[model samples]
Target: MRKLVIAISMLALAASAAFADPILDRQALMKERGKIVGGISKVVKDEEPFDAAAVLTQLQALQANAEKFDADALFPSGSDTGDTTAAPKIWEDMAGFKAVEDKYLADIKAATAAAPADVDTLKTQFGAIASNCGTCHQTYRVKKG
Candidate 1:
């Protein structure tokens, strides 16, 4: 009986780990996006001198990541647990959530194509991109304590 209990416990642990993987992957992806955004923002805010090439590279990366940010795969039904800041509403209103994601991705792609050549251009483009990001976060993400 004790051995059976141990086996059950192990199975539960493995199940939890498997469930946690998508959450971890989503968090890591978001962090990467944040870092790229921050880097671009610094130049836009004059906190860093403008580097057109670097900004372009970061924008390209943002577009690539946004393209790969598959909400369906990342936010599976049981993914709300374990380090995830995704609100339950994501799964509840899956269509709305996906629309927001699609909009954000579209905005990112537009910004990438624009390839801001100067600080002023970057400021305008980044503002639109950031606004789209905030919109999704406001509706879909839960603030973590």
Candidate 2:
């Protein structure tokens, strides 16, 4: 009976610990997205002329990463466990969330494609993408403690 009691206590403690924090795979995804987007934004705004080929390569790579961030992953189909910065409205209004992602992706693609052509044009398009980040964050993310 004593062995049984100790086993039950251990299981209870383990379960409590596991439930204490929210687990999220989206954090890594967001971090990578920020790095790629931020890099491109900085490069475009500064109008630095490295080798044209190198600039184009970096722009393309950033575009590819932006394209890969699945909308579903941004707002999981399952329980969020309160871990995601994505607002509850994201899940409740799936279409709206997808539309934001679509706009964001389109902005990145256009900006990247244009970067090699004219730095001025790239800056304009990239600015549009950056604006989306602020817009989404304003509406969606809950302020962290």
Candidate 3:
């Protein structure tokens, strides 16, 4: 278990290394996070087979995704413009931004610690973490087109 977490951490860091441009890096991270959620959603929806290990890995990877943010670097000064959908409110209320982010990480950690081995339990835990995504997006993202 420790090895898996360490490996996921290394993969997360290595992936982040590709994004020298903070905007691009942040964007990529968001997409990766979404993809992680989507994979879990598939299992929840029965669109894919549920292996408990796979589900747990998904949650761990999500936690790693959350940890990748160096908020200030990801949302640096004057980054509220250009080819991005970050809401101005991020810069306007960064404390609130970080709080929401912290909440997200905490929820992911809680779900992971639960190590939900059954689909029903996974459903409950998954809902909590998934809701955080919707809540944050509403507050921090600008709808594009």
| Root-mean-square deviation (CA) per prediction | 5.4, 6.8, 9.4
lDDT of 2 at 104: 83
TM-scores of the models, in the order given: 0.83, 0.69, 0.84
Q: By lDDT, highest first, what's the ranking? A: 3, 1, 2
The TM-score between candidate 3 and the true structure equals 0.84
| Total clashes in model 1, counting residue pairs 3 or more apart in sequence or in different chains | 0
Best by lDDT: 3
- Give the alpha carbon lDDT tens digit for every residue of 36-70 in model 1: 89988889889999988888899999988888788
The best candidate by TM-score is: 3
User: Candidate 1: where is the Cα deviation over 4 Å?
Assistant: 1-20
lDDT of each: 0.86, 0.70, 0.89
Rank by TM-score, highest first.
3, 1, 2
Candidate 3, residues 39-67: lDDT per residue as tens digits? 99998898998899999999999999999
Model 3: how far residue 27 lies from native, Å: 0.4
